[model samples]
Target: MFPTPIARTSSGTQIAYKIALPVALVLWLLPLIAVALTSVRSAGDITAGNYWGWPTSFNLLANYTAIFENTPIGKYILNSFKVTIPTVIGSVALSCMTGFALAVYKFRANLIVFFMFVAGNFVPFQILMVPVRDLTLNMGIYNTTAGLALFHIAFQTGFCTLFMRNFIKAMPFELIEAARVEGVSEIKIFWYVVLPLMKPAIAALSVLIFTFIWNDYFWATVLTQGADTQPITAGLYSLNGQWVAAWHLVSAGSIVAALPPVLMFFLMQRHFIAGLTLGAVK
Candidate 1:
């Protein structure tokens, strides 16, 4: 039922694949290219309706520098790091334990609980905005990084648990059984056996969660405001004047905000790929 690999396909099919590859890649990168181009264009170029055309001048350094000088982008970046890192760590760690319990231990409510995690993923988050915002306000952390991160952790854990449970389930059950026979404690088995095997998954989940949380503009806006707590995603709006929008600076800030996740993917590219394709071959 699976599609044949391109390497094993007929010559005409292979040629078609080769011709389509670059076209698809360029199409995918087109918007990013536009954003990058916009980031370097002069403000005059933007004002004079030169978007998507050749730039009159490249204000590369000036545009980048102007953002730092004229805005609180630096603090916004720090706030993003503070929020994203903790959320990724918290969500993944919680998922590992929850997934392990659900996968390795047979309990009466196992499927019911697992279904609950999966169910949360289907709920539309936009609908929760009012209540989540009101809840945060009541907790007196309505505009804090911790509040934002906590909400992200709670929301993300559901998906992370779904991801990790499947990975753990695919693991050989004999390892846990053998550990039990050897008088090894359950926690030790998880630590020494399952967790070691879960490195690829952990790395993959970390990168995914980091990107999601970093790029989360909606909740960032809903849960927090101002440079003190806002992530780079929402803080980009702060570049606007009351009467005017600085599209050039906003584009530059967007490019800047996107860098961390891109760098993160590149840094963990190997593990990330491995995690995704862990069981594909078999």
Candidate 2:
């Protein structure tokens, strides 16, 4: 059974919930608040060990500007876009077709094959790093945008398929049957009917995958090298001088790098909520 909502709970419980909410929220946001504070603090503030304290000076514009002027952050951001966009498109596209087949078609191996895709999600990706790296090296795409994007696409397809298959399976079979009676081909049925209906799911999944790939520092570092090929996640690590950590610049870059996914979630918030809340999917 689901837990009772605060509105339906006893007055004492409701009061506790109200009191706890802001406390928890502040606790959650403490680190982000620190980062934002750090991003604007002058370099002297950082050098003098002023972290988690009042800034001696604010270099909001200067800190932000220095990242663009002094580092390859712009290129790293561009590289993140290149990898993330293609991975989102590729994984979502593949999942739609595979989802339709696994959801609608009746076959002996359907569940088994579907389970195979689902099973991939459970495997620890860390274990596969060595082999996956070797795979890219052997394929001659190591340290390239294409290789990183391709790897993300493949790894993500498993989860995307699981998300989409359950969504498609919940769609009314009568719709597909209606299309067949109207002499519509399967491809058209999928393209015009199912795909049109899948917009919410696509939007939600795109946002999720975009956020995942964009924040993927682990894979970004493991699969690629240097600023030219690395995403903003890894590129943030490169913001330091040889002898210095330059935490302020890294914090500034962190703020810059976080903007896209935050904007993405806000833009797709409507569709993303709808996709998750649909009765069938729920």
Candidate 3:
């Protein structure tokens, strides 16, 4: 049961919704607007503690250039890409295989195995920090991009599998049966039939996982160190000075750090919406 459409609601209710929507939207975007404004602020304005006031002089180009020239933000962004791209590909690939198996096959312990993946999602990752750190250290991968990417793939697969499994299960299973009657092999059926149908879901999930891993600061801090391995999320701290926190440069870096995921979402927006709404009706 969906909520009543606003058009059919009472005039009072419709007016209330109209009034509340923009208010709530502005409230949500206030911090982001502040950050954008701060990014263009001059150091003189920052030194004067004029955080919320109109800019004395805009240093948009200067501040953006300074972060790149003065810090290892470029390397940090490269490292973020190194970690995030591989994690997205690996996690989604593994999940698709696991989801296909779980959705298409009937087997003893199927639910048990599916539950194992589902159960991992409920475990608070904070508890795994110490052990995971020790494991990565023991494996001599504590501060490497590969180690971080692999760890993310392992951790993210659980939720990805859950998402993919439900989507796959919602599909018509009779297609697989039709493929079988035509003497198609299982692998071909999956490759030709199922994979095409999965493009929207893959695009949507890639955007989701890219955002998740790209903006990840916790594990980025815990598992990696130094600009050589640190993603932009964690490396933004380097923009701060010892005697002074360079809020302007930090804000600029934040904006720069956000571009990839935002661009990714926009590029995949059509597929993303299609994937999410595919089965919502009927």
Q: What is the C-alpha RMSD of each candidate to the true structure, in Å?
A: 3.2, 2.9, 3.0
Residue pairs with colliding backbones in model 3 are none
Question: How displaced is residue 86 in candidate 1, in Å?
Answer: 0.2
Off by over 4 Å in 1: 1-24, 240-245, 270-282
Cα lDDT computed for each candidate against the true fold: 0.89, 0.89, 0.88
**Tens digit of lDDT per residue, candidate 3, span 49-71?**
98888898899999999888878
**TM-score for all predictions?**
0.86, 0.88, 0.88
Off by over 4 Å in 2: 1-23, 240-245, 273-282
RMSD in Å for model 1: 3.2
- Encode model 2's per-residue lDDT on 148-182: one tens digit a residue: 99999998999889889988998999999999999
Ranking by TM-score: 2, 3, 1
Off by over 4 Å in 3: 1-24, 241-243, 270-282
Please write out the lDDT profile of model 1 over residues 84-163, one tens digit for every residue: 99999999999999999999999899999999998997799888889999999999989999999999999999988988
Q: Candidate 2: which pairs clash?
A: none
Residue 121 CA displacement from its true place in model 1, Å: 2.0
